[model samples]
Target: MSYLQKGNSMIRRTTAAKGLALAAVLSLGLTACASSDDGSGDSTEGGGGSSEPLKIGTILPVTGTLAFLGPPEIAGVGLAIDDINAAGGVLGNDVTVEWGDSGDSTDLSVASSTATDLIGKGVSVAIGAASSAVSLGVVDQFAEASVMQISPANTAADLSGYGEFFARTAPPDTVQGPAHADLIMGDGHCKVGFLVQNEAYGNGLRDYIQEALEAGGCEAVYGGNGEGHEFAPGETNFGAQVTDLLAQKPDAISIVAFEETTAIVNELVSQGWDFNGTTYFVDGNLSNYGEDFDPGTLEGVQGTLPGAQADEAFRDQLTTWYSENESGELEDFSYSAESYDATVLAALAAVKGEATDGATISQNIRAVSGAEGGTEVKTFEEGVKALEAGDEIHYVGKSGIGPLNESNDPTSAFIGIYKYGADNTYTFERQIEGKIEE
Candidate 1:
């Protein structure tokens, strides 16, 4: 079966099991106003009161294409919020969050509408639209409304140039792309094959990889969009594409795709391809393949990403929290850590703003995360202290510390190299600097 057919089957199965009411809720048009209550917990209030509580809006793919990644991202946000509240809330006001699902749509008009509704209800900061395409769709709306949007996992190259009001924790695809290409071409490889998804995320990686490969004196044997069908993030069945790629007999194959790449990996293994000699290079989106693909099939595969695995200190804290909470097992992915950092940064910005308004919050973000100050921020408390002292703070997060350029994108990110082991686990090989020139 083709990828499109596989995607359709999965959606049908899920919808049938969830029933019509849930599906209706999922597909319902964006509501203009979300019901709100005043301090008395009754329906009477003009503003939720500047002194009452802090409201933050979150947008993530909770139900559709990128659903697998949403839970961890949301968990990270929740963790940051809990930690802040436990520490006596920001600026002495209780913090609250309202969440909306983005459903992985390329055109995020519905999600943008949801954000506007959150703004109407008085949220000062918004975090999410996990997919880059979705983030790109709603950036203008956030800018128009003066809402500070801090995305946890938007890596598209175009987003940093969106506006001053937007910020992303994840490094752009351009940074990750060249790193993967270097890993493949630097291994004395001559020719490589490419299988890319037809989207901004896929094309961005493809462009960077091609440039890096050519620079490294490697040639591309087969380069184009992956065939079989257009599959959303979680779709399966890439057997035909893999079979065609195997026919080319390249030294390596670069998969600039997502979960669909896992299916191709499976097909390659099933066909008894020479795994010892041929390499499979995947982008950061395939970081979670261990959870989705057969363990034995992924042995010897390689992947590149912008950040390292959750540091030991942070993982210990998260493990303790999960033991006391009902959020379930946390997967080890870069986005989870980035999500926590983004939320913390935004909250710090809000506290720095003092008034809890988006414009003030946006200005504070640039002040704290930018390079006007010394480039080091160790903890949330230290950031708060710096902001309180009227000193420009450079927020160093779990991802890394860097300056946001004119585009609002971080100028650099730590690049991590990972290899898949026989047990279907990803082992961190090493870290490199992702430095790109304008």
Candidate 2:
């Protein structure tokens, strides 16, 4: 019931550099005031923390190709902290966050520096690095320092055992991949081609779904092995790749590129591909395409994004919270719920384990997340109260992430199928329940 298995197991559905002079000033300033990452999670030794507050550092894509994701993620973590503090804080001390930018895969150095800076600031838990590759760039730094690294949207399947310190609220592509394949097959697309990026995010996901397609008696025309084409990071010109894939004559095309998706879609349209009919987009390309393309350019496109469709009330609340607190617009909610859940889970782990350092939180996370449940609690307030009463608790996240498996990936999650309309924006068409196999 905890881990989803298939074939007797289950399946589940699943930033910037500055000028040199300014850089020197910033480097020295940061080093001069940074705290030690001695597994203490205490900042009284240096910076970004106080004697009592629990410090959570964020290394999300605040700037870069994935910058569109930053607003909601930041808002999500912010709201969780607000709610926790309102409920009397973690361990009777407020939770403070240090923000850092995680540039996309094209620039891992940005994320790496920010992560090291945060760890040096003595954070017990850090949330972020949205892209799977982005997370990979900095996860080891945190793990080595005994800092918990919880991600909102690093969904690559191979990242399952990255480290004891690494865990993700986002379900892996192993779940979402099969869901996408099933949807395509269900829609009667027997021949498919893939146009994905070269990085782990695209290639890894493409591999998972290709297995499902073959298993379902479908043919992967251009996505398997030597035939599959991979675009290097920042290589926006998908013209040649599109032409070669068109020659493969797939009935359906699944694109798994990121910001470069805008250009790829444009080229696809130029090549006379009726995107409205046989095009599939993955989370990386499943945004309100109207923002980049002309209206109706992405109409009829279908895609899969991990996590449940946040109900209207939750969406509105997050929007309002972002407007009032974060001084930004909630352009997208793709990973908002997951972000909130990850942040809240860290705080709850701190409470349940009676400690706020990285190793302590890591040891308690699975226990607090229903590994061996003592009580079922949802909100941080409820969880804290239950712990106060000497009750062990299981936290069912607001995002609905199920109990984590041995690999620290969620055992159960929701994969939302999305369909675009005339406006290039998409709406949730249905929810696919995904389970992870042992």
Candidate 3:
């Protein structure tokens, strides 16, 4: 297939952008306005005969409920940027980057403003806003602006076909949902009560878990979407929800939530529920709860998240780098590798297409992603060598996401099971493997 000619491509992209913009204006009736706190004011860089360098904007949640996730995600981005620049950046100019925060879906104002600001600054590619629903809220804006968007920790299946410009390293929750149910059932918890946040991530995972639990002969006792038990966003005070779940008297409870996990657990304890029974958790609230819970508060609890255990050596390296760049230490490494891989993939795509424009980058992403007929290269510098030698290169990163599926999602990933200790911190249990059958 022949690539679009530069002139013709410009016309098509402009027309597409205009149409998408019009559609956006007509459909977006959201009243809440977002404000971006961390973002760059750099000039746009792309195929418009501009000499400005390639610019990327990181929009992961740098604050709010998911703040525990910020460290490793930012570490992944920072490390990739350093590696790419050291290898002689895309199209001869060092890539420039801007940082922004996406609080959560509850507050669309933050991510919405961040996306608008990043698009205005001419960012060729945008990464993040970890929440699946949060990403959904503003993805069209990036798509219309012609900015390639990559998310590192979004797993909602609803976003599977969000747009041609959207890509995510995280596998949809369907892959891990069964693992969660199987683990709970296998542990002999025949009856289960589920407490979910009632959003994309929570509800989607809940559907799969319910099916698996029933299939395994376990009963889904309570808590489902619109069941009057589903927690509303920012609806704090889980007192009522806990009281309701206890009424079901299930042997086990499965919780998929964000920061609310801590509050929910506190409620459970206050109401005479013990963690001694099997209590399963999902990615959102799997962080260290030591500050809030007493020793042994979560001692036998289990949780699961997508992604294999990061290699020990790599974890040490990332920790050192993270501490130097941002703050204390790398505590939760949930999507760290995926974040690194997403950034690197975007950068390599920019190089392969020889343009920083969103459309151009998206067009060439496969060439650097172990596509058919491409020579494999493991590092950015190595891929650069292959490019210099006039060879198409397939670049693989630390995440091991090989190539993307037709949906622009990772072809392979792992679901890691974790067990909590006396200190309310989790330790790796086992990894469930996944791959697209086709």
Q: Mind sharing the TM-score for model 2? A: 0.90
What's the residue-level lDDT of 105 in candidate 3? Answer: 73
Candidate 3 lDDT tens digits, 114-170: 776667657778889699888888898888777788999998888876777899888
Q: What tens digits encode model 2's per-residue C-alpha lDDT throughout 69-185?
A: 888888788778877887888877877777678879997778777776676567778898789999888888788778889999889987897787999999999998899999899
Consecutive 10-residue window with the lowest summed lDDT within model 1: 3-12
Per-candidate Cα lDDT values, in order, are 0.65, 0.79, 0.75
Candidate 2 Cα outliers beyond 4 Å, as residue runs = 1-37, 40-51
Q: Rank order by TM-score, top first?
A: 2, 3, 1
Residue 132, candidate 1: Cα error in Å is 0.8
lDDT agreement of model 2 with the native: 0.79
**lDDT of each residue in 322-387, candidate 1, tens digit only:** 444433676655567777888787777766666455655666666567656754666677776776
Model 3 spans > 4 angstroms off: 1-51
Give per-model TM-scores: 0.81, 0.90, 0.86
Number of the predicted model whose TM-score against the real structure is largest:
2
Q: Rank the candidates by lDDT, best first.
A: 2, 3, 1
Each candidate: RMSD to true structure? 8.2, 8.5, 9.0
